[model samples]
Target chain A: MNRRDFKIISEWIKKESTVLDLGCGDSTLLNYLVASKDINGYGLEKDIEKVQESIKKDISVIQADFNVGLEQYFENNFFDYAIMTQALQENKNPDRIILEMLRVAKEGIVTFPNMGFWKNRFQLGFLGRMPISKSLPNNWFDTPNIHLCTFEDFERLCRDLKIKIIEKKVLNNSYSTNFFLKLFPNLFGEIALYRFEKTN
Target chain B: MENKFDKKSVGIVVPKTAEIKHSLSLDCGKVLEKFSLVFETYGKLNKEKSNAILICHALSGDHHAAGYHSNDDKKPGWWDSCIGPGKPFDTNKFFIVSLNNLGGCMGSTGPNTTNIETGIEYGPDFPIVTVNDWVNSQKLLADFLEIEKWACVVGGSLGGMQALQWAISYPDKIKNSIIVAAAAKLSAQNIAFNEVARQAIITDPEFHDGHYNKFGVIPKRGLSIARMLGHITYLSDDSMRQKFGRDLREGKLHFGYDVDFQVESYLRYQAQAFVDRFDANTYLLMTKALDYFDPAKDHGGELFKAFKNTESKFLVISFTSDWRFSPAKSHEIVKALLKARKNVSYAEIEANQGHDAFLMPIPHYFNVLRNFMENL
Candidate 1:
């Protein structure tokens, strides 16, 4: 099945443009971009096996830790776009990464699991336990989602980083957005997709 | 004869020598007037002649890359595991070309061969060849074979440099280039190792200033030392520890450097085997070529600029424990390829086999190669 998120991300990319996919696990999205958008895509993945898998797909992928910045490898505005999907919270420095992405590419696309989703709020408000739901599946003690945030929190951070959000889409856990979910994105949306560019 | 080798093997192959009618000018400002290239081919070339791959050899590699020469042969070719019916490079699907480069000591022309004018061994007279010269010679070979475009050009270490040069020099001649455990140029430290190896050979009294063949005396001690040093660089500390682990060969210390350690014994055996077959002059020439390889030198010193004209896709692989030509070097190539907007794939395999990992049949390494070839 085509990942709805990948379909959406592929749609936003310009044809035949250069791209860098951050934390490109298995490089399925980059692969999709090459096939769909005819883009020259590169990926930076931490896991070696995933890097190998990406090679098998005939995709150019560098095995490198995302926590370690990428400025040294890429020059300013080297790529047409930089894209990261569902990997904002479990990072040592998400803000630094966003700025680095902007430094390397003309534009960027980011996605993360939304913390203000109604189900997450129910776990925190009603049961009085740490938020746990479909998107945030791990127990609070062992969860990798360390810096989970709501919609407003992300917007404020983006504003602080001088990254202007060009477009924003909020989707449910099934990767779909509905009329009601769009009406109350912060409380109802489980996933967040944002396209941004440098203010300058 | 009954089939005695493994089913997947190409089996009972023979090498053929092709006289290069075209004179090739060397990068060292000399012309190769006459030379022969010894080559071996496996698998059938399709009618379209599209499914053909070229395998370039490293410093000591020859055209004998796969299969057995005789029914009684003990071991198969160097890359037998990778050049068979169902292996990576898969002979069942693609025709594979392996050649002894122009300035090689194998059946091809090199220091071991007689000069056309002097009627004696070329020895030190074998003009110092470079990676560029090798690629140009390979182009002639491709022309001789009538292969319009190679499906892929593959190599490891110095061989990998040749692959990169192949892509850069004759971009339209290859569809893909697989470079494993190599860099665009030798680092200062890498050049130092080669210098040391060169010094060892020249210091031998029997070396006779690179004409040991004149006196029928091989520089056994000197060449052995050089080969031993190369052996050390090709393996990692982890692999060495796992293999020898300070294990005493004689179960006790000999105290007099009489091969007490198992690692020492292993190195000696390899050195002796190498010294017997390898020509010291050819070794010297090969080291010089490796030291001189810098594809970016002419392109405004920008590696990416060198690859700007390349149309072939690239797959650059490196081993984790290969300190000799580490993953960092491969990354440099990948970065340049990215800057050039070329289709490139980089895979740094988690291997303890060091630079020698490319020759090994590591399941993961082989899997990536197999998949890349299959997809192509």
Candidate 2:
């Protein structure tokens, strides 16, 4: 099933654009983009099974760690877009990876589950326990979302890194966005998608 | 794309020999003054002569890569499962050529061949050759066939190393390369196994300093043991255990060392069959060739620099369970190709068949090959 964030992420990507999907799990995003846009791309996956899955689908994927840096695999300004979905927070250095993405591609599209949602806040404030919701579905001790951030935190980080925020799409659990949800995305939006490029 | 040829019908073909009266300069500073190469071809070479594809064989593999040698033959070529009319290396679209290397025993100039200098079998006197030497020899065969450039060079295991060497040595001569279950260089452990296999043959009582040919004696026991050891490395533990667990050869075990387990019997049969068709000195040279394969050594110890001039698009594949030539080794090649900024595709297939998985008819593996070839 295509995630709501992926659908939004696809809209920002131009047709036939070359993509490098970092932390590409099973490469469903790459496959979908290829089928719909006829785009040429490769995926970098650390999981062996997922890499095999991508290969079986006839998708080109390299089994590699994103944390190890992309300079070894990609040349500067090589790809039209470098995309990472629901995998930024899990990276060792999300800021460094974003910078590397901009160095390798003209633009980068990133999507992650927002940590500042009202439900997550209520669980921590009212229940006096670590938040656990449908979006963040892991126990506190066993979770990959190590560097989770809200929409505001990501925007602030992007500004500090001199990365131009070209576009942003705030989405609820079901993808529908109301006026109030747009106004207070950090508190209401479950997932946040952004398209950014390096500032001149 | 749909040719009306029956997909199931075996391509009944015979191998031919190309007599090259010219000397081949070996990589180890030795020259093969004259030799003949036994090779098999499938399909027609197009008008442009551009559809030629070379299939390099592994250590024990021969010139028979596809089709049945005889009409009554029960099995087709060694790689028949993937080289038929509609198979991955589709004969309908590509002219496939596979040859027995210079030091090979299968109808080629090898230890079994009579040396013109002394009018005796070369045997152990066969000069040590490298993968580079093998590629150069194949290049001569290509020149004789009037093929300017090959559409693709495809191989697995040692054969894959040959494919890589073709791209590195003759960069512009190849358009694509499919290297499966191969490595840039053998690990120390890999060399140890080859050394042990060589020792087994050399230490045999029947082996009289490689003079067995003159004495009309074959190192059967030593060769058999070497084949058995090679067989164990070819298959994964899971595969061997699955194929032959603790099952007894007989209904009950005698508790002695006389082939109690079914696995022991299976290894014996494999060894016997291999020794009957293969020569001891040829095996020694092949292993030595494998041990010395390191394309990066001459390029300032940089594999990426070695491919700086290569123009061939690569499709590198490895099986997950192939610990002998593990995914890690395959990744080293891929990393170098990526660093070189060459067009490359890699796949690690899910398989438990180990190193021999490259020869199997796994759907995913065949699909990857077909996809890459179609795209090429």
Tens digits of per-residue lDDT for model 2 on A128-154? Answer: 888898889999999998999889899
Angstrom error at residue A92, model 2: 9.0
Q: CA lDDT of A93 in candidate 1?
A: 79
Candidate 2 collision pairs: none
Which residues of candidate 1, in runs, are more than 4 Å off? Answer: none
Q: What is the lDDT of residue B329 in candidate 1?
A: 92
Error of 1 at B176 (Å): 0.8
Query: What local lDDT score does residue B121 receive in model 1, on the 0 to 100 scale?
Result: 81
Model 2 CA deviation exceeding 4 Å by range? A1-19, A23-41, A46-60, A64-81, A86-108, A113-149, A156-191, A195-200, B1-6
**Candidate 1 residue-wise lDDT at B19:** 94
Model 2 residue B332 lDDT score: 85
lDDT of 1 by residue, B220-298 (tens): 9999999999989999999999999999987988679588899989999999999978999989999998999999999
User: After TM-score superposition, what is the CA distance of residue B57 in candidate 2 from its true location, in Å?
Assistant: 0.3
